[model samples]
Target: MPLCRLAGAGALTLLLLSSTVYAQSSTATGVSRAANPALSANVLYLVGKATRHDALDEPDERHAADADEHGAESPGARVQEFELRMTSFVDPHVKADLTLATHGVSETELEEAFVTTVGLPSNLALKAGKFLGSFGKHNPLHTHRYPFIERPMAHETLFGEEGLNEVGAEVSWLAPTDWYTEIVAGVYNGDNPALFSGEAEEDVAFLGRVRSLVDLNDATTFEVGASGLTGRHEELSARSNVVGADATLKWLPLEAQRHKALTLQIEYLRGDVGGATRHGGQVVARVRVTRRWWVQGSGDWLAGDDPTVRRVRGLIAYVPTEFQALRLQYGATFSGDEDTDHRVALQYNFTIGSHPAHAY
Candidate 1:
């Protein structure tokens, strides 16, 4: 995305982000405004990826013919990629987000197109369109929020590349609390697994969390939550019911009883299910190595009988300013069947347009 988009969407994201320096100006007539409301809304995004599969580990019996995460089976295949996302808001509480990209980094087809945000009341916010699912907090967060460039494999596998979005409605609320606590739940059609994620069904889904980290006095704070989806598809359906839970702890070394500053952190996630049961947990560590440099590492262990999936990646990122970032990383996988492959990638991101402020 472009710098122009970042500045525009900054406000759209305001409710989702920790308070910023720009917040201000309340009227007795009953309305609030930013000291600087925002100029024009615009967006531009670009990304490319190149990967080599020296050996995609394939166990003796795990069908190589089955389309996997990459949707490929042949060896020595190299994958390249591209993406562009742009959105603009006409009103403070309403906006449109559109994403266009290739199926393996090429112009094979359109990737994502969705519209979001219509604030109704203290406990109601609505979204309707085809986009990424918000099952886990991480699924809906932007690329900028993450300490590393890539999301954990657990996320990639469960949500797929698009992060599990479909034609649906989502509702969120601010629960009464001394600290920040949020509840978000959604209902939609499962994609067509054979071609898409499946189709909509008779069932609905829910994801809820009790959080308090925003502006907390404690340098270290915590959160615990659960997310699950269960739907029954009629005849000839490939429905996979799921249920899960997650917990996080942020141990910021530097305390600022009064401010927002860089902090080192670690987090973990675990989930239990019937279809993809014992999907496992992950460990993440991140550090702001310098004013302009950041380092992060993450590891995962799959718990099911499946061996084709285990992953770890290390990353280094550069932040010239808050609006943009450049990153490089090394990703390795232990798919029980495919080779323990390795990958190298480059990513450049510019936050665009008025959208929302939730971080990854």
Candidate 2:
């Protein structure tokens, strides 16, 4: 069957299963409705314009084309994405999560469907099924959770539009240390055309990461992480290796945690493909101005093998409540031998039902 149909059927089945669970839990003695999966929907609407339409195209043109074919409007105004998410414990020892997403009015797609072990011995955990890989900090964020209007240029250039999401299994261990520390390893089907595309059983991609966190003071904390991946590169017809490092510093005053805060994040990535090396990175700073207002700025750069690309962006956001937000952003991109592109965007985001908190 077609992929869209299959995804739709899977979503329907999950919805029915949730309903059945709710009915059973409501009727059973001493059982709470919480036994049913938590369901949530998120929507993002965008209205924006760019100096050059070609430069404004999403990194994955194929997926954008699918949205266009489904009668989505031109780039200036459209529903950026609509996502339905379900999360719940499958039993005492396992948990499941599913995310179905549609871009514009495009066909629904299964973005993620994964199961994770709830408890294990020795601070170890296991996860399986199709999910986003725990790559650098930025690669794991969902669209609505992005601090800026769009992804950094470096990330889009290396990981395509969707980042490193794939069918995979992962194991993670939390160390018994004073500060928070974790080690993770995973293997995935090497099928991302932009970077990896091996088809054989043995031609899989491997990833490893180590992350640690420390509290600098009463109101400050710091986190650092390093990640490495090796896989078969289809375009180069050879093996490729990518390594990344990231750091984040944040401050939130105890007495004014809601009204004031600051965060600084930096990430660097280096990739070796076919004897050539490329380097990319981004720096971002964000400040909470008031209880419901925020300001953010970021710079991104990429170099090696191709013309260097740089981007700068700034935005201000007003989040009236936990469920809705409005933001206006301006960005400029410069590339060697190409005309600079300036863009402005206004985005509206809203969510309904029970939504999980994002990672810190």
Candidate 3:
């Protein structure tokens, strides 16, 4: 059979399967979700194929060792995640939130469990528990909030594939500056896979971030931030330092604030691992063509001791409502002195209840 014909058949099958699953799940629990309080679930289904050496399925050898230690798997077509989320106000002074993620069929993990202060003096708030580090914008963003299906190569190389998260405590403050400014500092147990795997009481990682937003006009806005992390690499028994900067610009017409918008975002990260420095960057732009249609493109570059890898990606998404989305993405990656790979992915994301808002 022709490749195009085969691809078409596969696409049709996936669409049918996804629709059936969604309908059944909705019908089975519609009443329960409607009656429940502070509980919700989001399911992400992804299907894809790779042409030539599937780098995603066979990540760099260096990181493969680390993933093996934690039983992480390579990229593939599967139920990416079924996230059960719970949020509630514990009392007058505190709020609690937790996310439990089920990957594939058997792997279930506590993705995030944290509590935050409801009200604090001096424009300050405190957070404690296990959560993703606030080292950079990308590190803190969940998969569903990502513009692209895959994370930037910088995250894969500097931190583990899952970025960086640990049992930690954070203190954040809103500055009194004219522009919207905030600063955050966190200390973690340094138990991430490759970045920091030390569990000793004294072995810890410290990170800080400063972010500011400016409104250029009623329709335009710009935000920029800097972040840094210092940690111990127990595997290598060396000191690790990572520094990053990110910026985003957004525009929305006053008349079509709900339907049309444009966003440009970019981030750069540099890491020093035992004196060996590596750097990578990614830039993405998204344009909303209509109330339910959007297109996004991204470019990624990673260079260091290994062969430099570059990738270009484009995505088109349709959001029928606020709770569901369908997206298609195509990407091509090229590594110097290595075979280039092309891939395509289709994803469906749906929420079943009153989900909490994502962080800015």
- Which candidate gets the maximum TM-score versus the true structure? 2
TM-score winner between 1 and 2, please give it.
2
* CA deviation > 4 Å runs, candidate 1: 1-84, 90-93, 102-105, 108-119, 142-150, 192-197, 200-220, 233-239, 251-278, 335-340, 346-360
Estimate the lDDT of model 1.
0.53
Winning candidate number (lDDT): 2
32-94 in candidate 3: lDDT tens per residue? 354343988989888877775345532557666644444344446678778898888877998
Task: Arrange candidates, best TM-score first.
Answer: 2, 3, 1
Candidate 1 structure quality by residue, lDDT tens digits, 95-127: 776666543433343445565677787866677
Estimate the lDDT of model 3. Answer: 0.84
TM-score (C-alpha) between model 1 and the true structure: 0.64
**Candidate 1 minimal-lDDT segment of 10 residues:** 37-46
Clashes of each: 34, 0, 0
Least accurate stretch of 10 residues (summed lDDT) in model 2? 54-63
lDDT of each: 0.53, 0.84, 0.84
Number of the candidate with higher lDDT, 1 or 3:
3
Look at candidate 1 and tell me the lDDT of residue 323: 57
- Model 2: per-residue Cα lDDT over 160-239, one tens digit each: 66678878899999999999999999999976655675355556899999999999998999999999988988767798
